[model samples]
Target: MAEIRLENVVKRFGTVTAVDHGTLTIEDQEFVVLVGPSGCGKSTILRLIAGLEEMTEGYIYIGDQIVNYVEPKDRDIAMVFQNYALYPHMNVYMNMAFGLKLRRFSAEEMDRRVHEAAAILGIDELLDRKPRQLSGGQSQRVAMGRAIVRKPKAFLFDEPLSNLDAKLRVSMRGEIRNLHDRLKTTTVYVTHDQVEAMTLADRVVVINQGVIQQVGAPLEVYDHPINTFVAGFIGSPAMNFIDCRVVQDGPNILLDGESFQFPLSATKDGMQIFSHLLGKEVILGLRPEDIEDREFVKDQKEGIIKATVNMVEPMGANVHLRVASGMHHIIACVSPKTRAKAGENIDLVCDLSKVHLFDKETEKVISKSPITG
Candidate 1:
């Protein structure tokens, strides 16, 4: 395993900038995932690191070697593509052994590595099956197995599970994570799926419009996004953003969203960070889970806000309520037992401690709940 580093990397496609000057370090044996929407340069960045596509500027280092001019085959990196890039005519055994054969490995060495990788991937029984006869997931495993036999310094994956069914994607996700834990190989993965990034990464790199937005562990980035784009991008159902006016009544600081207002009872540090904007426009961000059913919350530190239910979507574990509080339309994830009906008004307890404040002008996060939560 080896650490991978990219320094001021830039990749341009003639008139379009595919990847701006982006720098990142992936520690040895760590699994880092690059995630963003399509055309956001995630795949381009991954290809740059793999030397599949040359960077227009900057340098890529694998371990102690600068690989900017290194050929992909000599870069000591193995890549697993979205399409599994397997040999259609070769059986699993031959395909997995092909790389070793090209590199002039002894017959015993090739057989040992092939069987070991197949056993590790639980694909021992399918060694004789041709790629044409394999399922999507099996084909993907064989693709990964091909990389494993090489035992390269690092493994690069480009949305390897995209072609699989949802259930298969989830199952493959665990298998990949488990493989990482066991092999401790340095891995750089690229995907547009936030769920996959959250589940399979040691650190997630959020890239958008060819720029790096934020880098952190899954929950760290989720709980405290650095900007509006990341706030709206990281989570499922997404965080709700309502433009509100800050009104101070006596000792309480309240946000008046033309339709409804929620009290801001921030901790001492939180207050110090946001108290100056008491009378200005600020964007209030609250996760769906942060808005709870009034009946379930015993302690209501935050005042309840009434909203007219616009839609009710029942997900298995929780119910999603789309409600309008005056001109602001937002979603609240509440208990499945919530009896709130469409067109009816209901009170939702906005947990002030869970609130996030962002500057209206800069669009950068101003403050967020303490990490203890």
Candidate 2:
């Protein structure tokens, strides 16, 4: 496996830039995922690395060699696409062996590599089945097997599970993770699905408007996002953001609003950051899970914000409640066992340590704390 690096990478299409002054180092044998919303250039980064799209500026390196001028074939990377791109007439074994045949490997070597890859992917039993005859999951396994047979320096996946049904997508996600673990290839995956990025990546690069917002472990980014964009993008149902004025609470800081006012705990470094925002409007970010149901909260915990329940969504194990605190609306997760109705006044306790404070104007996270508030 090779280490991949992009230094001051820039990709431009006419007057518009698809990737803007991006720099990142993907470690050897690391599973890195590029994630963002639609039109965020996640796919563009993948294409650049694959040599499918030339960069307008900067350098791309694979291991110690600069690959800016290298042809895609010589780069020695395998790419799996969202469409699976299988030849309908060919069976699984033939499809996997095609790349080796083009490279002119001996028939014995080709067969050995193809069979090995198929076995690793647990698709050896369906080697004789044509692409049209195979299920979506089977087709995906074949695409992966084809890439594995070549044993490239890196693997690039461009939303490979996107075409599958929800259940199949979940199953394929596990398969991809297992493949990365067993092979330990330097893999770069691109997806707009935050769930896929969170579940499958060793590290996730959150990008927006062709620029990287934050890059870190999935849970790390989810827990302590560097900006409002990341905190809003990384988690399901997204983080709850409410505007408030900062107020002094003894030596610490408190967020005061129309319906609620709670002291920000001194334990969180955010207190110091909020010092500058005292008496000024600041954005308060709290994840749905961070806001606990009043009944389940511990009194010793600091910062309790009260709100009126506005809506409820029961999601099997847990219930999601959208509550309004004065003019601001926030979502909190409640236990399914506890019955909650709309219009009910609910006490939503905010974990001060888990709170995220953002600059009202800059929108960047000022607090150094690494977990979701």
Candidate 3:
């Protein structure tokens, strides 16, 4: 219902900083997700905006009002916590109505709000059941139902799906997104789960060690990560990082790896960035999905690198291969019928267009694909 903005926000505990000079604006009716590893200050940012934790320095604005010193209740935000926080003694109906009742709404009004919320969440039949009688998914629905009835300025969810089983988590995730679509409520969700962040958010804010790494649409960040940390952390199997020294053979920029030497493509802008770094060390990053079985490769002879498979994990749709090339270990995802067995030398084709280059010292991605221009 309202936009949330944090400008130059700083939250510190003694000598350690949890969030450093953070500035971000969540547009009205937009669903934004704060995603990072644990202890990376994402939850702190949420609490800071929720007025649960006072900012050590800087200002927080809910809508146009500067709420830096406002109380949590006065901020008019609803938070769905990880633990669900449902009172065991109260049935689903009572739990959903508690907030409205406290605000002194009439019985008829409470009935309207509670029933509307329960219908929205598809928990109308479970309204008479206590928390003890419900499943994990049902309990979470009750928690969400409670927040829906309040109709707060914005919704903040802090790993609310952590308690559910994997299958239920997937189902609940869809349910929550659908609910957001219908309500059009401004929502800020925090999660360490990159998959959840990728699937649920309109925009993802990546944080690490009290610093903002990148902020963009999930696929945008995944396709063109700003740094090695963002590149590795955002993907499921994690991007493969190989240490190599940059090589310059006249006009061509080359990467000389452990057992492979390949010329960088010229499809990217600013070749001057790599031209000066020849002979300097850099990290070559490739996603597992980009490496495929050589036999199925389009350009088999062009960018194939040979490595010995160490192990193979047979996932239903694809097989994951752990391969060793000289001293470096890399994982590759290939078809289940790859025919590449453990200890066998296999020709793995690298999709050059999907490869990444990172500065060894700063660890920032040089480009999405090998830069040519």
Candidate 4:
């Protein structure tokens, strides 16, 4: 396995910038994922590293070698694409062995590598089957096997499971993670799905509009987002943002808005930053899970606020509810036991310790508290 690095990487499509000043380092044996919305340059960045697309201006390094001048074959990298670009005429064994044949490996060497990779991918049983006979997941595995057989310095995956059904995608997610663990090959995977990025990556690179936004472990980025874009992008239902001005009343700092005015509680973790935003316009970010049904937090309650229920979404184990405190509409993930419904006013208390505060202009997180419950 080898480390990959991009320095001042810039890719342009005439007037439009596909990747802007992209610079990042992928450590040896690291599973790094590049994630963002479409037209965000994720695929272009991957192609730059794979030597598939030439950068307008930048340097890509594989290990200690600068690969800008190197051909894809000489770069020692294998890529698995969103579409399983398999040979329909060839069976699984031939498909996996084709790369080795192109490299002119001995017959025995090709057989050994093909079978080993098939075993690793658990596709040995389907070796004789053609791509037409295999399911979407199987075809994906074969695509991966094609890469694995090469024993390249690194692996590049571009939404390899996008074609599979939701159920199969979920199952394949686990399989891919397991495969990475066993192989421990330095890998870079690109996807727009936050769930896939969070679950599969050793480090997730959040990019937007051809620029790097944040790079961190999944939980680190989720808990401490750099800005509003990432705050809304990383989470499942996402954090709720409410516009309000701060009001200092006695020892408490209150957030006043058209709908409601509430005191901001200071937690031990965020006391340092909380002291700075005394009377300023700040955005309040609360996750759905951070706001709980009063009944659940009452018995094991920490901090609570009362509001009127606007809507309720029953999601199996918990109910997602939208509530209005004044003019502010917030979402809360409460216990399925919550009997409150729409058109009803209820006390919806938020775990203040779990709340996040961000600057209105910069959109940067100013303070956050860790919640145990």
Candidate 5:
């Protein structure tokens, strides 16, 4: 295993910059995921690290060696592509053993490595099967086996499970995580799926428009996003944002939404944080899960909002509500027992302790509530 480092890495194609001055470090044996939307330069960063794309500027290091000009074969990294780049003509065993064969390993050594990898991936019985005969998940396992046999310093995966069905994708996610845990090889995975990044990564590097947005553990990023982009992108159902003005209602500070208003809970931290923003417009962010049906809440008097339910989706464990309160459209994930129905007025209580405030102009978070276990 090796620690990988990129220092001010920049990659540009003519006038378009794909990666802009990115500097990060992947600790030895750590699983780091590069996550963002499509065309956000995550794959480009992976390619740059794997020596598949030349860096327009800056340097890359594997261990202590600078490898800006190193050939891909000499970089000691194995890459698994989204398409599972397997040989159609060769069976699983041969395909997995081909790299070692080219490296001129002894026949016995190659066989042992291939068998070990096959067993680890639970593909030992499928060794004689060709790529055409294998299912998508099995084919992916073979591709991973190919990478594992090489015993490289690091592994790079570029959306490795994109082609699988949803159920298979979830299954493969657990398999990949288990593989990483057992092997403990330094891994860099790239994907646009937030769920995949959240589940597989020890640290997630969020990118947007060719720039690094935030890097943290999944829960850390989910709970305390630095800005609006990170806040909206990392969570499922996305956080709802409402534009409101900070107003003083006598001695209490409140967020005024024109049609409705709620007093800021009298927490010492809340007072200190919102005192300076009086009379200025700010964006209030609330996660779907943080807004609950008032009937289910223990304290129904605080942070109450009345809205007309626009739509209702009954998920197995929870009901998702799309409601309109004044000019804001909000989504709330309430308990499955919620009596809220479409076209009816409902009362929802916001968990003020979990509120997020962002500067209207900069869209950067000014205050985020502490995360509880």
Candidate 6:
């Protein structure tokens, strides 16, 4: 295991910049995920680290050595691609042992390593099966087993589970996490799926338009996003953004949306925190989970918004409501017992204490209410 570091990394293709001055460190045995939408340069960064792509400007370090000019084979890292990349003619055992064979390992040593890796992955019985005969999940395990037997300094996965079905993806996610726990190998995973990043990463590096947005623990990013982009991109249902102006209602400060108004602060300190934005427009952000159906809310005195339900999706444990409040469309995750239905007016209680305020011009978070739940 080794720590990997990138210093001022920049990758450009002709006139387009793929990665812009990215500097980060992956601690030894830590699992870091590079998560972003397609064409966000996450895979480019991985390839750069693996010595597969030349950095336009920067230095990469594996342990204490600078490897900018190192050949990929000398980088001591194993990469698992989106496609399994298994040898079609070779069975699972040979495919996993091929790397060792090329390295000229003794037959007995290669045999022991291959079988051990297969057993760890629970695929010992599938050793003789060809890639064509294996299911997607099984093929993925073989790919992982191939990487494990090499015991490289770091493992890079480029969306290894994308080919699997949803249920298999979830199951494989657990298996991957378990594999990491047992091996404790340094890992860098690239994926566009936020759920995968949230569940798999020790630290998630969120990227957008080839730029790093925010790097934090999943809950940290979810609870306290650096900006609107990070706030909207990290959540499942996504946060609702409403345009509102800060106004003073006698002694209380309130956010005045065209359709609704909510108190910014009832306490002196809360008022002081938001006093600067007295008459300026700001964006109010509320997560779906933070908005509750009025019928289920115990305290209905604050942050009430009346909306016409446009659609209702009944998830097993919760219901997703798509409602319109004047011009703003909002999604709220309420309890499954909610009586809300399409075409009916419903009241929603937005948890004021969990609200996020962003500067309208910069779209950067100016203030975040303390988390109550």
Winner on lDDT between 2 and 4 is: 2
List clashing residue pairs in candidate 4.
259-326, 259-327, 297-301, 305-349
What range of 10 consecutive residues in model 3 has the weakest lDDT sum? 265-274
Tens digits of per-residue lDDT, candidate 5, 1-373, equal 4999999999999998999999999999999999999999999999999999999999999999999999999999999999988999999999999999999999999999999999999999999999999999999999999999999999999999999999999999999999999999999999999999999999999999899999999999999999999999988899999998998876667888776677764556656767898899989899999999998986567678889999999998999999999888999999999999899999998887788889999999988762111
Residue 160's lDDT in candidate 3: 97
- Show the lowest summed lDDT stretch of 10 residues, model 4: 265-274
User: TM-scores of the models, in the given order?
Assistant: 0.95, 0.95, 0.96, 0.94, 0.97, 0.97
Model 5 poorest 10 in a row by lDDT? 364-373
Question: How many collisions per candidate?
Answer: 0, 4, 3, 4, 0, 0
After superposing candidate 5 on the true structure, give the runs of residues whose Cα lies further than 4 Å from its correct spot.
265-270, 370-373
lDDT of each: 0.88, 0.87, 0.90, 0.87, 0.92, 0.93
Residues 101-123 of candidate 3: C-alpha lDDT, one tens digit per residue: 99898999999999999999999
Candidate 3 vs. true structure, TM-score: 0.96
Worst 10-residue lDDT window, candidate 2: 364-373
Q: State residue 49's C-alpha deviation in candidate 3, in Å.
A: 1.0
Q: Return model 2's CA RMSD, one decimal.
A: 2.3
lDDT of 4 at 26: 98
- In candidate 2, residue 106 scores what lDDT? 100
How should the candidates be ordered by lDDT, best one leading?
A: 6, 5, 3, 1, 2, 4
lDDT of 1 by residue, 1-373 (tens): 4999989999999988999999999999999999999999988988888888989999989999999999888988899999987898999999999999999999999999999999999999999999999999999999999999999999999999999999999999999999999999999999999999999999999999999999999999998899988988999889999897777766556677776666564446545655687788989898888897787785764547678899999998999999988778889999999998999988888777778878899989877762122
What residue runs in model 6 are displaced by over 4 Å at the alpha carbon? 370-373
Comparing 2 with 3 on TM-score, the higher-scoring candidate is 3
